[model samples]
Target: MDKDWIAYSECVWQCRSNNESSHQTIGSSQAFSVNMASMNEPASTTASTTHQSQTEARTTSSMPNITQHSLDHNPDIFTIICCNDSFQIALDHSTIATLLRVCKRVRPLLSSKVPRFHSWWRNVGLWRPNGSLRFALTPSEQIALSLHCEYEGIADRSWLDNQADQGNATALFFLAWIHQIDLDSQQSVNKPKREAICQQIIFYLEKAAQADHPMAQYDLAGCYRNGLGVDQDPTKAVDMFRSLAECGIPQAQVALGGCYENGEGVDQDYDTAIEWYSKAADQGSEDGRLHIVFLRGWFSFIGHGVEQSDADAFNRWHEVSTNSTNPVLKPIATHMVGWMHYLGRGTVQDKPKGVNIIRENRSDEFPLGESESLAANWADINSDSPALRKFLGMCQFGSDHEWLCKHLVAVCLIHGFGTRQDQEKAAGIFEQLANEGHSVSQLWIGRCYSFGKGVSKNDEKAFEWWSKSANQGNSYGQWMVGCCYYSEYGVTRDHTEATEWFRKSAELGNRYGQNMLGDCYKNGCGVTKDIDTAVFWLRKAAEQGFENAIYKLRQLDQWL
Candidate 1:
């Protein structure tokens, strides 16, 4: 039997037959057959009558005998046959090639094996002969069907290397996995060969996993589960995850449980996916943990995977909510907890605590370590230092800091951080820094003038300083500049310009900008009337505690 035909035939049989053993026997080659039949389904249908009218193309090569063993060893035969039934139901509406392409995994293999008679290699970066993906295959017919497995394997390796170089961790992981699978080869590798490829796969997986690649974690777990390349130590794989688990990798935690739950490389004990799911849940990997919860619950409810205990599943799900670090799941867990309390699952029904938990878990506070610390230190050191004391007199005497820091030192004299307090020195420093085009210092100086923090009140001077900072994309300066434009303070009134600055600030997630943007939208000042957009902006600002925005949102909602 032709290998391709046998694979395809197996797919057909697999789809129709419900034999479990028969299905498992149909191996990798079956995937190819299913792919070919799928791809050509629609074409075959549209040209059904014509297909038969035209005689089958004759070839001089001897036909291979179809055998039961061949059909029994491929996934393609089963899947293809299943698709055949589906195609018959909608034959006129679908194209065979289109259907075949749906099975993405088998498409390339099928394409490689097809006999190409009149094809050209022109395209790059894509499959198909005219497209990229050059395979070393010969054409016995119109399609290129004589591809060598070694050539494909080399291509796979190259593809994986390219993906890794491009920093696509997921692709890198899958490519390594494909290498491990080695579907094209029939013989089991010698110990040396197997170890070499497996070692390469482990290297690729390690690189990807360190880069927080999800698929890499999943496959790495599988490797640990099966003891492929490394020693069959599930505990080592689980131990590989201190960093990943803490860094919020959900899949890693799931894999880590294998060691704990089965005691494969650790101690065997049933944890029911609860402990791992809790860790994953906290990292916003609720989807992954949800699968665990479902299985655990199903089993406990009737003991499918574990001993029967409806209470155990219920309690596990509760933990999935309260202990989860994922904010999205917090709300779902909150609701579940509320329902559980209402129904008296375990704890007394406490609606208020559940509500509070949901509110608290909506969004985790991002750490203000590097950026905030830098900004604050810069603020403090610049405002303090004894060197600023000597400079203050010189600054007042029309002398200035040789550099921006000198000016900041003078401001420090006025601010009394390291020098005797003197507003005059501070004002002088502000003048120097603002004139030097230091955006942050300019905004600060503008703020001082606007609020009369250290200088005589001056709106015009404030606007000038704000304008300079706004030009450099300072968020606060942009906000003030927008205010100036909108209020026509020391400038021409232009809502369009106000809106422009507002949009710039809003893009940076500034609450003040969000508020102004909502106002602009509401009044049709600089933008077209957009009630929805206005509401959205207002809500964002309100969430950030912008009082005016909150008031406006409430009024607008009432109107709606």
Candidate 2:
């Protein structure tokens, strides 16, 4: 055999042995293999035959004359080289060089037909037993490979720094990521160190971004958007995202859509947002699909971008309700679909189906109370359920015993359930009910003021309303009153008063109040420090599946 073929055969044999040993060491691994006629060749071949083969290889090396014919006629050989283990082994510089010398047709094919080879090498590393092949690697490639290997073992960070200093964009990006991780993990007490790391991260990220490293551009855009280690600049963030979106990056497409939708750095354009969202969805992004469904429903229902079409709204919401894998979004879409059915907006009226959907998706595990039952009955009547209306006499004017219909109407206005959303009207109704001594209405009035839903946000007003409901023995109101005192929201910070209110709420079986009361006991906030009392209340809340209480109890157990 010729020297070039001999070298190629030796390299292939070495690679095969290494692969077998690696599989054995890792315990059941699979690797592709190449079948070569050279492997079965005799130990001896005349120099004349070797020379003849070399001449033939040279004559066939001409790309236009040989490559197309080989690809057309010898498709199996091309498939074996590209799809089999030979492609992987040829990634090694020595093997590829020898292969090129033996068969020049491979050079143009590899260069033109498989542009993804370099990216695959960079991401997955070369398939050598000793890890990545180092021959012919640029400084950035070296730093990237080293950082990639750090998941398996420790890496030399100083070498990465040296590579970055040598103007390696990838090394700079990698170093920035490392420093960002360090800053995240460092304690608040290490302020100077954290600040230094943050500055270094920003510097390296900016340098790498300017060099057009995709990840660096994405990360730097985020920093600009959030004012994290950089001046907040929505325009810059939009520009970066647009650049990446043009390159067909799905995440960048999503961000660009959000920017357009919110008018952050561009005009608010729901049509543009939908267009970008559709692009991302075409790339098989679940989030993109969800965004498209939501935007379509909102635009159709509100007549914002597209023409208002109840049928379109129903179709979009139905798609999400039935097909979405996101737990949070699925329930929301289901509720919207149920609302449409209940109101007979786009589909036939189906009150039973609507009610069943709401019941199944209700977040609270507790059975519906009398008030909830009354509200459900009111909804049935509102949906024009003839049997329910007759049975409850709800069709008659002024037949709303206990003000259930009025309360349900207010809730509908507040949430836009069956009526146009009007927070002001909801708040007015709630205030009237509060004046009539309805504890739940008092609590809702407090929430409205606290969040400025319909009235000017006033912590003092919120506290006053909460106190009224608390005096009427509302557990949630009592808990809110305790929180007000604890946080000094609308009153002086008084731990004793906070604890008293928490105790009252906890006694009424409020899990949040129970957790707070336990914390107060543990920390000696209002009452004397008592570990047993703390554990008692914490266990009560934890048993009710309060996540905070469960975590606190676990911490206390560790202390014990």
Q: Report the number of the highest-lDDT candidate.
A: 2
Candidate 1 global TM-score = 0.28
Report the C-alpha lDDT of model 1 over 264-356, residue by residue, as the tens digit.
566654463467757776755655566466435334534455565546756765776656554333333444344344334456655334333
Residue 168, candidate 1: Cα error in Å is 70
Each candidate: what lDDT? 0.51, 0.61
Task: List TM-score per model, in order.
Answer: 0.28, 0.44
**Could you tell me which 10 consecutive residues in candidate 2 have the lowest summed lDDT?**
31-40
Compared with the true structure, what per-residue lDDT tens digits does model 2 show for residues 1-560? 23433443454556445544644664321211111111111212112346436534643232223233334555555545543443442343223333434454554444432323333434433324544332233222332333323323223466556767866666687678667655655567376776677889999998876654565777788787667777889899999888777766666787788778667788878789888888888967777788788667755765554686778888998998788865445655666677667556778876445545655554432122222321211122222222222112211211243343355456555554433567898789778888888776788788888888778999999999999999987777888899999999888999899999999989866677899999999889989999899999998878766678988888888222
